[model samples]
Target: MTMVRLDDAMVLGMNGAQRRAVREALVVAYPSRGRLEALLDGLDRSLAHYAADQLPLPDAVFAVMAGAKAEGWLPLLLAEAVAVTPDNRQLADVVGDFQVGDFQVGAATTGRAPTTPPSDWAVIGALADEFPDLPAARPLISQAGLPPGRQPAWNVADAETFWSEVHRLLVDGAVVDGWPKVLLAAHRARPANPVLAAAVSAAGATGNPGWREISGRP
Candidate 1:
């Protein structure tokens, strides 16, 4: 069977609307709804259809998982969960057979940056300032070599917007260490940031509700 996949563009396109739809669907799919494994199974089963009445279930499921800041093992776990499904069964018995100890949910990484820069000098400079450790940010900062406190008079508002894109890239799978902590710093820098909020909310939905508590919001 072909495994379901979510690409960069699709994951980046997730928004509040899709998140809400998935949540509602989950409530119905798993009424007991306590286990993360069950939720993962439901999501995988839902995606087998991929589309229902024009609503894209895979996109919504990916939106939720990516927002959750799941580790690199997520794809591996999903693959394992789906693989065990009985050919004669309707829905999978993933949760019953799942053995968390059998898998390692290690650090997530997006691999590398593109050879070509995607942002303008000002935006890149601002990102470098914000996340100096980021792989993509480092090269831009080096090439521009804009002195400290000498960045172009770019619009600060646009920096916030761009930071959302950066957040998406990181959580979606960057060589991030302590991803939750990184998210906290991002939220601190930009209070009420939608992207940050979405990221936090995603993490909350997937058993790790720490982001919600740290952000001090429901």
Candidate 2:
């Protein structure tokens, strides 16, 4: 299996809103400590590059750093960067907030970024189109849990089975990674299925409660 690098510039060039949406999706889909560290490191590198070149820092950088601060690593990670790149005025200004305790370290370590929310389905569809090869980019039924040789019929039986499996996976604390995209893919496949529609809706609801539950699983 080919692994996509998180720091790909093409992926990073998304407009502020889209980039934030994708980052939120990634946090929910892959909540491991290692994954979080990689993301933080990527953000650090991007910020350092922007600082080194004196390029205007993208809005997404602050947004992502805020997320890392809330995750409790921003202070430590930014401190390291601040130590290494003292001449990066922009980086110094951002890290100053953490040093002065303007931002609070969150009690919780992992979750969505606190900001304007976007439609999960729309974001998934857009990302899938924009970055089709990335594992988390496409939320196809085939990637969720469809059995081999079976196509997504979106029939009642298919809908019920799919929903049941997803519910079971979530409740059993299984690693249902990329499930949000999977649910959205199902909704797209059968827009009229109440179960799927509701699941999709719930997945994108305020604070993304459904997604939090899924991501909370081991």
Candidate 3:
């Protein structure tokens, strides 16, 4: 494998292995203790935000909708914002515009008018450009297998099925809401399955804050 320099910007076109190698190179590229500390701080902040369940949206959604409460669907919107801006402030701005009709979410498919459009890609691209090395974020839900107006059913699915579906969702890098609850429910369903227990523990270690929150871990 070619040891690409950490400074390489050509990573945008590199294969998955190359990208993984480049990320690993960061440790050697910034050898200073101070640099490493700064890097650690940045990683912590980003991971915490990414793993968080409720990303704060603009206060305007409630203001405009008049008692419009956040439903399970709202996290789907926030996940879309997170695909672009992981920071609460930036996410708030994107979501603010989203709520108020300034930022538009386009649908994944075209031909007929979509019930809800996907997150605005132009804005997401602009944000990705500003944030170095940030992979464009995607919604937690997959556009595939979706009916025109229906929501995903993974939320209420049984443990085995939820396990399979959630695994597919994460592997595909799609966003999912209430994953912790799903996991806990799965655990409850298979309390005696040591393999499942181990898998659940490993899932939480992925730096998702919501996992711990729902699992009752620190």
Say which candidate scores most in lDDT.
Answer: 2
lDDT order, best first, reads 2, 1, 3
> Per-residue lDDT of 1-218 in model 2, one digit per residue for the tens?
11111223333234666534333333332222233335456555443432232221223344555555455544444445445444434334322323433332221234323322233433333333222332332246445543434332334342234344444553454434446646656556545433345456666633554444323422
What does the lDDT read for residue 133 in candidate 1? 44
Number of clashes in every candidate structure?
3, 0, 9
lDDT values for all models: 0.36, 0.39, 0.30
TM-scores for all predictions: 0.21, 0.22, 0.22
Q: Give the runs in model 1 whose Cα sits over 4 Å from its true position.
A: 34-36, 39-67, 70-218
Q: Give lDDT for model 3.
A: 0.30
Q: Total backbone clashes of model 3?
A: 9
Candidate 1 clashes between residue pairs 3 or more apart in a chain or in different chains:
68-202, 68-203, 110-173
Q: Give stretches of model 2 more than 4 Å off.
A: 1-141, 145-163, 176-179, 205-218
Clashing pairs in 3: 83-137, 105-117, 106-117, 106-118, 107-117, 107-118, 139-175, 140-174, 140-175
Q: How accurate is candidate 2 locally (lDDT)?
A: 0.39
